[model samples]
Target: MIIVGEEWEELAAALSQADAPQRVYVVGATNSGKTTLCRYLADETATHTRTAYVDCDTGQSRIGPPTTEGMVVHSRPPDPPGRAYLRFVGSTSPGGHFLQTLTGAKRLVEKAAELSAGATIIDSPGLVFGGVGVEFQFQMIDLLRPTQIVALQHGRELERLLANFARHPEVAVRRIPVSPAAVARTVTERRRYREERFTAYFADGLSQEIPLRGLGLQGRVPDLKDPHGVERRLVSFNDPENFALALGIVEEIHPRRRALTVFAPPFDPAAVASVRFGSLYLDLDADPGSMESSRP
Candidate 1:
């Protein structure tokens, strides 16, 4: 069960006061009850009208696996929500893949709008400090242009970023103290959570050889000179429109055959028009590995 305090009631009332479409963006530092608040808001809104919950927190995504922005539409209470529409960001963090992260978020949020959702609640990643963090958050807010922003902070941590939006007439910013019950997670616990998500995502995966001839390659394209370099690397198979069909791991790359052997959950290989390689390499048995590379 989600735990929310009385502070959320005001936010709920504000949301309820609006009859027009509401796009609420939830922002906070790590373990600041952003997700819990999002859950509460989504559920409350869904009870009245169609609501869309957009999970932009690629690291600890609730609607989809890590490294992808996920969205789910609910016409009623989301007790057991339907499958999420996913857009792969190609990284667990947005620090290096800013373009991909922002693009994915915009795409999912737009999709929610197209679905005619009365309320779209966005949950963001905990990247809200430092030069890169501040810039990324600012760009995201500018790009999404949410009708309301719910900032949950321990102190003035988010003021540096939220201050920029204070005077924006189109957007309303609500600041709430970080819940006293919010508990920080250890690094080890976070790693284990990602591992579990990756493991579960590929649990029913099968190895298939997908020809690379007509496919558009993206992200860290494997060097043909280093055939085994792509092994164990996470990748996403996208359709003609570049929407992710599913995620896979490069099991093998046959240079001569001009094909890639990928282990992924059941999906139509015929529908894959592009293969976007990710920086992460998953070894199910240990911590995920990363390869530094330029954004796709």
Candidate 2:
């Protein structure tokens, strides 16, 4: 069962008020129960009108798979999580790509807005600890211009980060309490979660030979022409608009035929408009080596 604290109850009440937030930006430090709070708020909002959630937490993500910023609309209360629209960030963590993260968030928010949901909740990454984390939060707040800023601070650690919004009278800044039942995940658990997600995503296990000449390629290490360059390397297949269609793992890079033998879930070859070589090399059939950084 989910633990709902009194403070969470208060936040939910405020969110349910007639004049409550429409575009709610949920932010918090790592392991501060941000996702839990967002889920609660979404459930509450769904009681009244259509609720849309844009899940931006690539790691430990619920709405979308890892390394993706995704959106889902809750037309009714207690809507089960599903991937509606997604943009790939190429990494589980947003350490190296703040701009990309921000861009993807903005695009997803725009998509959410178009849906005209009564309540739009944005679930952000818990990267609110360092310089990059601070900047990412700042840029997200500035770009989204959300109606309310729901920050889940464990303590004063998030003060400096929330300083900018402190003076914004128009923006309702909510300081909610983190649930006591919130448990911090160990490093081993996180890795296992990623591996499990990857395994489940490619469970159907597709093996297709994709011609390299048609799709645009990104990243450096795995040159499509190089023999065995992209073998076992994770990749994101994109549509023409650059939205991620599916995740893939390279089985073999057929240099002679100018094609990639990749294992991806069922997808149309014509729709595979672009390809990006990621740093993570996950081999469910084999060992996903000790170091699986998302930088190719």
Q: Pick by lDDT: which candidate is best?
A: 1
The Cα error of candidate 1 at residue 1, in Å, is: 2.9
lDDT score for residue 199 of model 1: 82
lDDT of 1 at 222: 78
What are the per-residue Cα lDDT tens digits for candidate 2 across 58-176?
87878667888888887764556444887877778887767777888998888777777777888989988788778889999899888888888767777787889888877888887
- The C-alpha local distance difference test score for the whole of candidate 2 amounts to 0.78
lDDT of 2 at 244: 83
Number of clashes found in candidate 2: 1
Which portions of model 2 show Cα errors greater than 4 Å?
18-21, 77-83, 219-221, 286-296
**Position 234, candidate 2: lDDT:** 76
Off by over 4 Å in 1: 78-82, 287-296
